[model samples]
Target: MKVHFIAIGGSAMHNLAIALHNKGFEITGSDDEIFEPSKSRLEKYGILPKEWGWYPEKLDTSFDAIILGMHARIDNPELLKAQELGLKIYSYPEYIYEQTKDKTRIVIGGSHGKTTTTSMVMHALKDNNIEFDYMVGAQIEGFETMVKLSQESKIAIFEGDEYLSSPIDRRPKFHLYHPHIALITGIAWDHINVFPTFENYLNQFEIFTQMIQENGSLIYFDEDEHIAKIIKNKREDIEYIPYHSHPFKIVDNCSILKTNKGEIPLEIFGEHNLQNLMGAFHICRKIGLSDESFYQSIQYFSGAAKRLQKLADKNSCTVFQDFAHSPSKLKATTEAVKKQFTNRKLIACMELHTFSSLKKEFLPHYKNTMGSADEAIVYFNPKTIEHKKLEPITKIQVAEAFGGNNVTVYTDSDQVITDLLEHDFNHTNVLLMSSGNFSGLNLIELAEKIVNKY
Candidate 1:
């Protein structure tokens, strides 16, 4: 297949490009600005555009399909050219659906925990010797590429995102999956710029439910009130399986699972992760995996990358970095880390980097979210808001929103780093949480310093 990607340097876009290139498709992509990892990965594939920026002259009827990325604007020159030529254009999600339409698609969708849940399911399947194509949001441990498509695999698992599919396709990416088996972890209002209100954000999931294939199954978290309502009102044709947090006993800083087959120890912890584990277990059940196999395989499952990933550890000091910017993720991650290190001083640092996190209205949802952390630190770059064309937010607003005397807020990146460096690290566990890089901070170096420094 001949495919062209517009604004393809995005993290997801570049990964998809590399996946397709590996699959023996003729791939070409263009972007005005490409950062590390994406730029290097694309270059490694030899499909990286020689020069950045859209080439209207390159778009023609000869291409089999044009894939659109979220980074591309509606007025992008290549997109306009493709439209002018009356060539078929597919949003990244739409194209993925087109490619995997014939397979038994299993889509994992939620306001949070989608990546971790999907990764867990993938790990279980892999360890059980299941062969399948998949797309997960995070760079997992065993998986080299985030996107994988094959003609031989009869099933495809996707980490379904609720965000907009593309600049042209305003629909949530998960809406296009039409999964034979689907999982919804929870419903939390996010993407304020697109959905505007909580109800509006929720309606997308309602629509997603209707899109499930006839006789398909939906595995959802029973603890989520909003999801419970949606599952209750759904048509009886689709099977609804609700799962709660796994029965587990936490003793001696380890989380042990209480299963029908007896106790099974796990590497990951927290009620939220236990909840996600149950959701993944149900999905595995529908796919023909036995309870015993699931448990045996899951014991080896660490976690998805950056979803409370451990960066450094010593006798009394440990550091965790997570890709958790949303309020739901923030609450879950903080609670998880605090629960794990009940005796240690928890220094939780999070960056308000996403569009939703930076919004004024969305700030209120974070109230008391970081209460579990002993020392909560929030960071945001004012220049980021300006670059994204968002309204500016102050440190006081962030501190007040968190509603904790323990919470400290900083706008200056250097000060945040400096404060962390100066803080006593003997018995403290630092949790750095953000979807962004904290304005290009080297997490590994910082983590090593925090763990070894006195």
Candidate 2:
């Protein structure tokens, strides 16, 4: 198989390219510019393009398929050439579906916890000697790449995303997967840039439930009201399984998950993670894993990258980081840390990074989401707003949207770091949340400074 990628430097695209390349397939890709990690990884595979610009003349009838990335525009020269030549063109999700059509697809979908839940399932499967083709949104601890494809694997696990698939594909990425075993962890309105309204956003998951293969299982979190409503109109052909926070009790900073066999201590804590773990447990059961087997493997699973990942700890304070910028994710992350460390002060910081989070209209959804934090700080770069062609918003707007006296807004990330440096964090837990870089702020370095400063 020969696959040509239009925007090969993307986090997902590059991994898929490499996965296919490692399968002994001919892989070629082009990107106008490539950044670190993706650039280095692609070069390591010897598949990096020699030149920058797209050359339509290089594409011929001999190419097997063209996988398009979201980074590419609709009028991309290579895409146009592929269309002109009548070559098979696929969005990332569409191609993944095409490749895994013969396998039992276990798709994890939700506004939050998708990466962590998918990672949990992947970790368990691998630990149990289960060979599976998988695609997750984040890099995990034991996985070499975010995507894995193999001819021998009988199952394919995908972190189903609700965002648009590609520049020309208006449908949500999850809509294309058509999973045999589908799990909706929970739904909170997200990707406002695409869906635009809560009802419209809610409808996508409804459609997703409808798309589940006949007689397949639908696993979900029972506590979420949105998920409850979706299940009310459940399909008749599929079995429905609902789970809660996995019966975990926090004893002296450690989490103990109560199981039918015995109590299993967890390396990970927090309510959201427990909920994610429960959702993953139900999915594993549907895929032929016993409760005891799942528990044994999951005990060794730490977490996905940037999903409440521990960064530094010293002088009785621990600093953590997360890929949480959406309103639901931000609230859950802040609340989870605060709830776990009840005695300690929780200094929760997040950046308005995505198009949805930066929008003035969407800001109000974050109201009281950070209320659990002892000190809440928000940051947004004005230049980012301008670059995204969004309306200018003030610090007052951000503060007012958060709705608390504890909330402090900063346009500059340096100010946030400086303020945090001078603050006393003894017996305090810090949670840094963002889908971005915090305006070039190196969070890992900041975490080291925070813990070692004293």
Candidate 3:
């Protein structure tokens, strides 16, 4: 199959391109600019575009399909050309559905925890010698690529993102993957630019539950009031299984899961992670994995990348970096670290990077979210607001929004780093959280410097 990709330098798009290429399909892709990792990986497959930017001449009717990325604009030249030629075109998720239509599709969806939960299922499946096609949002350990497709696999697991599929496709990516089995980790208001209101943001999931294939099952976190309310009147044809945090205890900063076989120690921790573990448990059981097998396999699972990933550790001082920008994620991650290291001082730092977190109106949602930290720091770049075309927000506004005397807001990345450097790393656990890199701050290097200081 000849598949052409527009704006293929995206994290997910490039991974999909590589997956299709590895499957022995003819792959061609272009982007205005390609960054490291994506650029090198695409080149390694010998499918990297010779030149950057869209080429109208490159669009041909002979191409079997055109996969569009969210990075592409609605008026992308190649997209317009493809539309003009009347060729088959699909958003990323739409194409994924087409590929897995015959397979048992299992989709994990929510504002948060979807990636980690999906990774857990993938880890278990692989460990138990199950062959399956899968697509997860993050680069997981033991997985060559985030997007994997195999002709032999009878099942497909997908990390269901609620974002728009592509520039031209307004449908949520998860909605297109009409799953035979589904999991909703939890619902939290996000993507303020798209959905606007909390109710509007929530209705998407309500629609998603209804889209599940007839006689399919929905495994959801019952603790979330919004999720509970939505599923209360769910489709009678579909089965609903509610889950909560698995039975676990923190011992010497290690989280141990209580299973039927025995107490299994976990590499991942927190109430949110325990909740995710339960969701993964139910999904794995539906996929024919026994409880014992799932528990055994999950013991080796560390975590999905950037979900409270340990960056550097020295003595009692450990540094963690998490992709947590949303209010709920920030709270959960902060509390998780604090709960784990109960006796240690916690320094929770987060970057206000995403569209939702940068918005002045959305700031109040973060009220007291970082209260678990002994010292809380919030960082935002004013220039980033201008680049996103968002209204400028002040450090004072951020401090007030977070509404805590311990919260210290910074507009400069250098200053934040400087302040962090000055702190003594005796028994303090530092948690750096953000969806972005704090305006191009190299976190790994920063973590090294912090760790070396001790």
Whole-model Cα lDDT per candidate?
Answer: 0.90, 0.92, 0.93
Candidate 2 — worst ten consecutive residues by lDDT sum? Answer: 227-236
Clashes of each: 0, 0, 0
Residue-wise C-alpha lDDT for candidate 1, range 346-393, written one tens digit per residue:
999999999999988789999988999889889999999999898888
| Model 2 CA lDDT for position 430 | 93
User: lDDT value for candidate 2?
Assistant: 0.92
* Cα TM-score per model: 0.98, 0.98, 0.99
Candidate 3 residue-wise lDDT, 414-449, digit = tens? 999999899988888999999989889899899888
The whole-model C-alpha lDDT of candidate 1 against the native structure comes to 0.90
lDDT of 2 at 24: 92
Off by over 4 Å in 1: none
Identify the leading candidate in terms of lDDT: 3
Those runs of model 3 whose alpha carbons end farther than 4 Å from true positions after fitting are none
* Clash count, predicted structure 2: 0
